[model samples]
Target: MLKKITLIFISLAIILTSLEAGTSKRKGTAGAEELRIPVGSRGVALGGGVVAEANGVDALFWNPAGASFVNKSAEAMFSHVSFIADLKVNYLAVIANFGGVGVFGLSLKSLDFGQIPLTTVDAPDGTGETFSPNYLTAALSYSRRMTDRIYVGANFKLISERILRESAVGFAVDIGLQYRLESGLRFGAVMKNVGGNMRFDGPDLEWGVVIPGSEPGAPVRSLRVPLQEFELPAAFELGFAYNLKVGEAHSLTLAGSFQNNNFTLDEYKGGLEYSFNNMLFLRLGYSYVNEADYIFNSPSFGVGLNIPLGGTLEASVEYTYRKVKFFNNNQFLTVRVAM
Candidate 1:
């Protein structure tokens, strides 16, 4: 436990140094690509409830430290998301117990852009070819309980981005802590997407430029293109959840989280969920984030079903729908199995 704390502090110190140096420049604008990726997931299932009610491998994505409470011998989950336009995202994760001492997990996420039209200065109009941009990340994580009520986790991630023939790759790390106060109350915090800047390297780097009018062409020279590399969208999250039991057949959960955005300001997310006899659940959630001149207000709804598979094995399916402005509503589905 002390070793984990030391590593967390070291990582934070590096992050602070990088932020102080890079943010001083005050760049021109933030890209749309940065705004599009890392869209929050699984929050729709939280439904304003506290952390003790949170369970399964999905918790690793939301709060890695929560994995310490997994009672199942092994767990696996898969989620597919249909995002704005034609973009799609898929996530897979698995975790297991190690002799009741700790839990270790692996997670992978992929974002795919179908095809985009390619254009050139010569063609101006269109090149009649399409380019696809792909983003992928893989993470390995470990979580351990420090006490009966406190837990901690850390993750190491490798990230990559590819567009057409150009690609950039980098690595990042995440740390998290969760505290369970009671059977139905929980608090959690996590720092995510912290790592080194990525640089683009590919065939595109082979292009050359001619200096403007240098003594009537003093031997055409090759010029190295400047690559604009920036920090990942790192952020911190604090959340609380509470569960209320009403009789023996029904329960209500409420959850809320505050996100401190690194590029922009902070955002708030809240949700509510109702479960019936531990067999079915219905959830609704809302989120608020500010853009330059507008607000990206999204509301989501979800449903979950739990099925018994004998010998303590359990299976469940979950679906969530979210409405986005200026685009078709998004949909996500996940399947989970635990023993």
Candidate 2:
């Protein structure tokens, strides 16, 4: 099973890379752009090198295949992010594992941009109106172990973006495979945000307008402006992770990932995590992005604490910090409970 999974993921990686070769980065062509933002604090702090060994609700966003690693029958997580420019991101997820039936998960992520005063051609400054833009993603995921060493999973998501009376809706899917060797080395691959294009439409786009050439006396008709369709922010990712024991209760993890992004540039990331007694964790990561791709492009740090709540129950709190160029650094806090 491991061999088969390996062959499949490698083939997929090759195919995706080949197809993406020579394709210029279409920086502004993707819709539902919020999907590009990382969801899990740990993953973000790790510079998104978490395709392997992710467990519970977090796995659904990184590499669904890793969902098979969930040791709990049920798990729940809540995450909050203080993004650049005062934007806020909130994420919530729940996972249920039913042994042979597989693992099922539901997750929601949303970005909150504070209210902005309405302005129009007639009102240059403000129209005395306010509106808030909203971006959200809702997903359902399923994963199962194909064998002791192989796991596979997929996720379907509904993505929506709304600004005042204008909005766009689209759907996407994520597929992943994971394989682990007895030596504790793990591999993972995933294809994310593959879906049809979307275009904005709403009453805001249709309003009364005067015709240039019409009869002497003509009535104004609401004309709808056509908006070009845009594809989703798609990407293919490959990653590897390994854990090494330094002492009886001390361990270290090293992870790395490479990605071919459809809407931007290719990227590589590396991360390290140190654990003490399986309860306290310290993590650091770095990411390299192709030139002119983005503003936030580098080092991140994180810390986490896990506490046992009895036999099979536990709770954890994690925090991550990311440094950006010429902007305030990003901060994320996540809380998780498992049973």
Candidate 3:
């Protein structure tokens, strides 16, 4: 079973790689970009290099395959991100594991753009009105431990975006695989945002126009301009992680990942984490792109504390900070509970 599962994932990786080839010309062309935003403090703090090690509810946004590895029967997570450009992101996820069946998860991520001044072509200066953009993604995920060393998972996502009176709805899927070795080495691969193009439609696209050659008293015709569809920002990522024990109460983890984006430059990420007695964690990570135009070029740092609330219940708090270029730095706060 493990062999067959591995083969299937490898085939998918090959197909996705082929599809991503020669896509550089489409840079900055994909829509539904909110899908690319990172959530979960731990994963973001690791520069998104935790694909191989992510577990529990955190894996819902990083690599679903790891979700089945949670030690608890159920888990829940909440996170808030202070993104660049005054954007705010809120994320919530819950997962339940059924022995011998699988792990099922549900997650929601919403972007808060706040309020913006509404203006039309005729009122370019001030319209005295305000509108807020709404972007949300709701996902249902399933994950299973195919074998002692192999895990597989997938997520089905519903995406919605609304701007003023215009809105777009789309769907996507994410598939992931994780393999672990007894030596504390792990490998992960994921294909994310596989879906159809999205096109916006609503009353905002309709306008009244008068024919140029029409005579006097000509009636104005209503025209609804058709909008072009934009492809989703798809990506394929491969990652590796290794854990080393330094003593009875100390350990270290090293993680790295390579990401191929269909609508942007490729990225390489690396992260280091230290843990003491499985209670406290410190992490540092960095990301590199071939070009210098990427906004998040600086290092990321984070810390986490795990507390046992009682029998069979545990709680965790995590915080991360990421430096961005030419913008306010990003920060994430996450709380998690397991029982």
Maximum-lDDT candidate: 3
Report the lDDT tens digits of candidate 3 across residue range 99-192.
Answer: 7899999999999998899888899986999989999999999999988999889999999999988999999999998998889999898989
Across 59-103, the per-residue lDDT of candidate 1 in tens digits comes to 667667887787888898888888877779888899998845799
- Give the clashing residue pairs of candidate 2, or none: none
Better of 2 and 3 by lDDT: 3
Instruction: Rank candidates by TM-score, best first.
Output: 3, 2, 1
Quick one: ranking by lDDT, best first?
3, 2, 1
The CA lDDT at 297 in model 1 is: 74
Off by over 4 Å in 1: 1-41, 45-53, 209-219, 290-295
Q: What is the lDDT of residue 230 in candidate 1?
A: 69
Clash tally for model 1: 11
Worst 10 residues of 2 by lDDT: 17-26
TM-score between candidate 3 and the true structure:
0.96
Q: In model 1, state the lDDT of residue 63.
A: 69
